[model samples]
Target: MVDGALFAGPALRRLRRREGLSQSAMAARLAISPSYLNLIERNQRPVSARVIVQVADQFDFDPRLLREDETIGGVDGLARRLSDERFADLAIDRDELNEFLAAAPHAAAAFARLYDNAAPAALRDDPIIAVRREIERWRNHFADLDTAAEALADELRLSRGDTGAALTERLRERHQIAVRILPNDVLPDTLRRLDLHARQLQLNEMLDPASRTFQVAIQIAALEFRSAIANLAAAPQFADPSARGLFERHLTAYVAAALVMPYGRFLRACEGTGYDLAVLGRRFGVGFEQLAHRLTTLQRVGQRGLPFFMARIDRAGQVSKRYAGASGAAWLDGDASCPLWLAHRAFERTGELCVHPVLVDGAGGAPAHWLTMARTVNGRGGARFVVALGVEAHMAADIAAARGISLRAEDATRIGQGCARCHVPNCVQRSLPPHGAVLQFPALEQGVTPFRFGG
Candidate 1:
């Protein structure tokens, strides 16, 4: 479904079992032979489009579920968990892992959970990391919320009018809540606040028009989609209350963006415009950062746009926001990205789109090439942050900014995940020695790199 053969046997089997149907019974319902169904369930054959349509029609479920199940805490995650040094002695191969995942998905999920529980205290207990992992688990796409927001957008007629004005009018007419733009001095510490007793939604006067619309949409989401947000936040993975709260806020924001852009219209506009950020910003009445963030969420099945990864980094190289979407860029998981990445240089040419093509050395795998676009975005209270959006190099052809950009291996900048994890030789910008490498020093001479390490 995503420009590839869909091999989702485990998901298909799970669905059939959830529906309380035997293989023969489900096969009869799907108008397929039992042997063929078995083959599909075993992942020996890809799930055909006809079969996906039949499943959707008969089960009354989103066809995306099959694909989602395939990735969510599935083989890739299990493989990553198994790659840890603690499990290095086991030497599990890919085919065996695949067979194990297919044969016992619940067991595989339990193992993943076990692996998470076994992680170091810093990673296991951090609420922010927990929420991020949860978000990545779903690839930042919430189908139900998107559907609900799309319906709400249609009902509010958001696409036909000024978005901010439409949301403001809706709040006043339906909810009887007046929206007030208070002086920055009055709301110095907050961008938005809702006073229930006063029946007012207050915003800081410093917010731009696009941000004001987004804040209003958030209020609407909090009021209208409370149940959906709560349901998503209620997932068992969020053991910590802080994680649940953070996830709930994130879901509200996602719904707000969906309400503003509406999935179908946004995807069409993205594809039509070749993903030109400026043009899409003008059309959607959103800012560049918002557009980039929304770009990471267009993972609807059979209608996916490019699998973009987005990050927001400050001048000090601290990453504040990261969504790994399908790009799976290793830098997102690190505390700091490579200095050579365009994101770090975005502040030098503020407000201008800086594009770069780079090859990232992943963990013990082939280097993955990416095309990254970065620009500085004005943050709250005069602060500025660089927002970078990236997609795999192969998928960059459809992007307007990537036009005439060379992604050839020889032309690309080679970067590591981070200084501590990178093993790239002779990198002058590396601030720390690569992890798991022995440092070597030549007493007689000094090279450009401060630290030399054996690979």
Candidate 2:
């Protein structure tokens, strides 16, 4: 193969199959010989830019599809799935995995799916995990929900008047549901509840204006977009009733967020403000966490915002909410975030933005640099949680928060996903040795960390 040439055999073959075209037919459409097309399909010859453009123009498809890394079920995703201790005996290397993926991408994806289905009952039946996995699978962007919300927003003229008042009036006029705010003593345990008998939606008086608006929007979602949300939740993967219920609730919240912040308007504000979280929050009348969460869902096809990853962690370092967006790093898959991450430190300086650039140790691939911004937000009942947003370091120039910050690797803090999966040696804050490492303890000498392990 020529040096630095593009090889996209799997993608080309998939496109051909999708188009239901024979190799000769596709070659004829592209004005190329069948023999040369065959070589390209087999990855023996590099796909030229001219051919790429011709394929795009002929098929009316995005040219970026051909440039995507067709690493089969995602290199990191498959690698993490194989890292399970059950596959320890196989001892698969990176090269072998790559070869297998390249040889049979569909089979590789099937194997990953099978592995997921074969998980232990405890992990498989966890409704929360299932819901989170489903969210990540869709990259937290639901076009149907976004479109519905945008239409509703336009009908309600949400951009012109007070959003909450407009939504409340809509409920009264359209659904005959009166919005009522009751004292905490009246509804001690519920934030929002719908009474079908009286056609009333009750909210706790303690909820702030933003929270009240969000709860109202959620009611709208439950009433208006029930079929859409139900259809999304009906996927076979959510066989568990609990999982389905959780997913439906998540979708409801997603729609509510979209209603509150219409996609086109919000995305324009995001770009205009250089993605300033505080400014966006104020403009949209949302809290810090809501602003961060909405930022991850701006993945409309042609007008995509920066691919940002968002997470919410409590004081105990437990991640309650996480969206990987386009930066689907394996670290975002689990709750074991590194102690050194700014999310943990945001607790010390509540309500203050903490910005840091860090090098995240990839599981078995090249390291990734990120520009992470974290701040504490007050949740319901006075509970405080840290919400962190991060984007790839290369995108720092476009972010307002990353201004005046150096993105050099040497100047960044080195952190890992967590101690159990991280192989960064001698980390002073490591709580456990990394997987597959040989632990060593010498009585005569003391290391920075409690456990010394061989790579």
Top candidate on TM-score is: 1
User: Candidate 1 residues 394-451, lDDT tens each?
Assistant: 8887689988999787798998867886778899898998767779998999989999
TM-score of each: 0.86, 0.84
Cα displacement (angstroms), candidate 1, residue 13, comes to: 7.7
Error of 2 at 55 (Å): 13
lDDT for predicted candidate 2 compared with the true structure: 0.82
**Cα lDDT of all candidates, in order?**
0.84, 0.82
RMSD of each: 4.1, 5.2
What would you estimate as the lDDT of candidate 1? Answer: 0.84
Query: Please, what are the lDDT tens digits per residue for candidate 2 over residues 1-455?
Result: 12336677777889999999999999999899999999988877888889988988998978756644332334545666765534544656566665665556677878987888888988878988778767766768898889989999998999998999999998999999999999999998899999989899999999889999999999999999999999999964566799999889889999999999999999889889999888888778888887888888887766788889898899888888888765655566666789988779889997899999999875555567889999998887788999988988988777889889998888889888777877777788999887777799898999889989765
TM-score of 1: 0.86
